[model samples]
Target: MKTKLFFVLIFTTFQLLVNGQGRYYKAQMHCHTTNSDGGYSPVDLVNKYKDKGYEIMFITDHNFLTDSVYVPGVLCIPSEEITFKRHMNGFFLSKNIMPDENFTCQQAIDSVIAQGGLIQLNHYFPGPFTDDNWEVGAPEIISFQNGPHMLEIWNTGTETVQTHDDKSIWDAVLTAGKVVWGSATDDFHPSVSEALEFNKGWNMIWLDTLTKEAVYNALLNGKFYASTGVEITEYQVNDYGTYKSINISSSNANKIKFWGPGHQVLQEVNGSSASFILQSHSYVRIELINEGILGMSNTYAWTQPVFLNNPLHMADNKNDIPYIQLYPNPNYGMATIDIKSRQAGNLKLDILTLEGKFITNVANEYIDKNNYQFLFDISPMPSGFYLLKVEFNDVSKTLIFEKI
Candidate 1:
């Protein structure tokens, strides 16, 4: 009886650990097909992602959803990438919303929302010179739009451009205290021969089951993480009175990072791999640093930050923390501010317009005991760039914000 009881206890503990670790599955949420502007057909792209061990694929064409394709062992989600002049992609779209080059960016967002589709600001920051030109020409037009469900924080094919622009757009939306998620896509336009390799930009999503409903619902609830190469070993959220702590662990990774607009590196311990304890800062990210010979890195841009408000300050501190970790200059409207230490203490958060007008002030609140987070509120302020100043523990950090 004693021996049997010992075995049972050990087995139960093992099961609990396995359950706590969570599961990771490789998937590709963004791809193209001949149905729109891509070179490959839906069937071919599905085969490609499957061949790459991707359990799921979302074929987002330039303005159309291909007829559903049923394949064994792989899930193909019918979706479209509404290709406006600025380009916004929607996954799990009810129907195709064609892009009109003549329509403004806001109009495009509205159209996608109307279609019962989740909208993502697709590669809006950097792309060809034409894209950059479009953004500059319509800075106000683009900045005026506020709420979006998600943003393509990274695209493997456009890594160079994505790295810079994603941060910019994320910071902008975060500063506004909006609930926005981040996603990664292959955005592949593969040739017939390359169809097998088309899903190289696949992101691994962690879900409870392998069903279309489960995957889509997980994404909507921000239950998954995105990745190109590295896989997440563990992720969870721990809520404290004044701050939320996000703990993440990865496998075969050289570095793990938590980056967004207002990024504050809480704890970075380097080893065969690394471990970090990030103070919740209103962003979703799980990155694995590549220690490969070529120094190439694999990143996982997962769900957005889930905000847990402190009931004591819910009314006064209603704004979610801003994404305050990007550049340019003279932010007049909203901005991100990073706080580095985790020790809980009185923190004074302030924002001022570039022209020297005081915008907001929140005083004497406890921060994370180990890590700090960014804070911004600009709902009442007028348009223009501004400066963000955070005062805590006799230390001051400031950043720039632009208002449109």
Candidate 2:
């Protein structure tokens, strides 16, 4: 019914230290209010979702910010749906913003970033009768090079009308190695009694506290799963030395399907829950399907892909430790390594091939705390992808970069 907007990327490491800190919470990150086109007021909308068992909700009124609004039992995140040629939901905004009369997709995205908000590209798939349906590709918001933080893989509103399935678009971005994540939204505008569109979709966020900051951190770390109806009790991925494996448990799921890079089904298991040896792939996510339930059909649960980064040989570094960033990423031999170390140590920087073969010990020096930058030249090596490893004492981190 509306134009397209953008979000998605998985840039964090997968080392979660679940030392009994976070708990799972139900969240409806996107929804409208009477502030825009929805029937309920902000307070009523929050109360409605709270009654439906949602612990967190974002108002996301079109062109308006609900920053001053609060609901007694639910967390009200300051968000707004920026309506333009394409529509996008900007979350965790420092302040509210309205779209320009002729706002382009990129401009909207830049606006969100300017305000330190995480943006989700809204529904890209429109119904057949809609002006911007699937036949007309979403060119303005398509590229993953500087795309939004996430994409709506399954939208309840779209599902209600039986149009705009975006699995194909999601797979294309994943195949291109963009490191994006998927989200399912209610996009609710009708009354809760209208079960077909109102509480049909949601995000199950894994966090320790029921605070806005906690939710933001979890989302940033890709620590949540999306569902239309099915409930995921547990989802885990562990490396058992030589091989990795994944285990999943869901409520009433008829089947669990594991997908690889190219929309390929790597494995499928029957029943409500199952586990499998993790296959070799750039990314992996599970799709749970169930028969009709609660006047809704084709129940589904989608997990964010487990993006693999090289593991640390020891325990994960404390959360407070600073991370390193490699810039001039696709450089012609010369590059910069920016370090913001929390602790001082003897630093050993080296380059290695993807096969674990040693390339060269680029730098070995005693480094201080705080911010530091080091430059390395790989002019002697051929153009290709390689790992840049920074080791300090017993802790080490690795980053993949390309030489052009």
Candidate 3:
């Protein structure tokens, strides 16, 4: 079944999709209140965070749901900490989830997904000085299906006692072929006067508006960076069909580092600006460190990740995919997919959501021809963005076009 077909993938940074059009808004994904085990009420927490210049927060009290409310200039969403043996958090929730007896971590993760909420494994890695042990390590985390969308890489509530960086765990998960984004939070449990677990950790989300859907989309697509203090001033990523590189600059960072799989420090710079070429590694995420501010330390910011090769995959992708182009991209009507293959094999082309959910099939055939061009009417599909997956034999590539 020969048909017009295919596309090639050129991976780029998050900024390309939203670089000049949008700005970053401060967010707190985890926090507690009197609903569970915190000192402040929902209203009080919202007011305090607004005063701190925060634009968004998910009030995650233990097993208790806080309805979405808007303070003068702040947006609060429904969230909760599923107080299980190994803790978990569900944000942007629509229902209150309660874990019953014999309920497992995978089950809890699915419970959040069932409600269309964003889930994360909270403070899984144990610090060297702490004796607390839970199934929060990568060994068990990678075993779950439909697992968390994010991980609490830096949680001040536990780091105050169990001081450890969860990046090692993040690398392990990425190495195991799982895609879990990194997140940071204050885990606020004290009053402003107590001064503990307040305004210490947060995320900067990229968007043009401050609304529930905007915030949810940013998080759902990894369009945010976890941070303690360091701020990102400028970031850009450029990738042609064959070459790719990324550059970032910040005012507060003393050192800029790019980390790869297995906690490998691929590149490090001493100054506030840095650039890295994405050539061989499967993926690399940026880290910014400012030793201290106001005689204090632990200020850092972590970008989600910029991948040369996607980690959440079935087989180790090879360098065999042919370079091709799709014209009239971000099309409203007619669009064409051209597959220029040198060797003959079975080919399959698909359109999918960025998260890899299949939307429609474009072509599937045994290709004996060198060139297959597909002209399909794209107006039938919705106007949102999606991915173009081209699979030729065992080698496949997902080309990320931010504007579908």
Best by lDDT: 3
Q: What is the lDDT of every predicted structure here? A: 0.52, 0.68, 0.73
TM-score on alpha carbons, each prediction: 0.62, 0.70, 0.72
Write the residue-wise lDDT of candidate 1 on 1-404 in tens digits.
Answer: 11010001010000001124336567776677788767767787688667778788777777786648777888876677766566666655544566655866566655543333455666655554225643422233235332245667666445533233235555555544545566777777753335333444556666667876567545644566666556666656665546556655667566665555454433444432443333445443445554444444334334344454411110112223321222112233333232333244556655566565666664447655332333344445566555556566676645445554
User: How displaced is residue 172 in candidate 2, in Å?
Assistant: 1.2
TM-score of 3: 0.72
- Candidates in descending TM-score order: 3, 2, 1
Q: How many clashes in each structure?
A: 22, 11, 4
Model 1 shows how many backbone clashes?
22
Model 3 worst lDDT run, 10 consecutive residues: 310-319
lDDT of 2: 0.68
Encode model 2's per-residue lDDT on 1-404: one tens digit a residue.
Answer: 22121212122334532225667789998888888889888888889899989988877888888786777878877889887766788887655677777776667665664343567877775565233732224343344223466777776766675433457666656655554568898888873436677888899889877876577657755678888879887777786645567788887799889887778888888888988675467667788988655434677888877644432211113323334545544456556665545567887777788786777776677765555656667656677777777788777756666667
Error of 1 at 10 (Å): 38
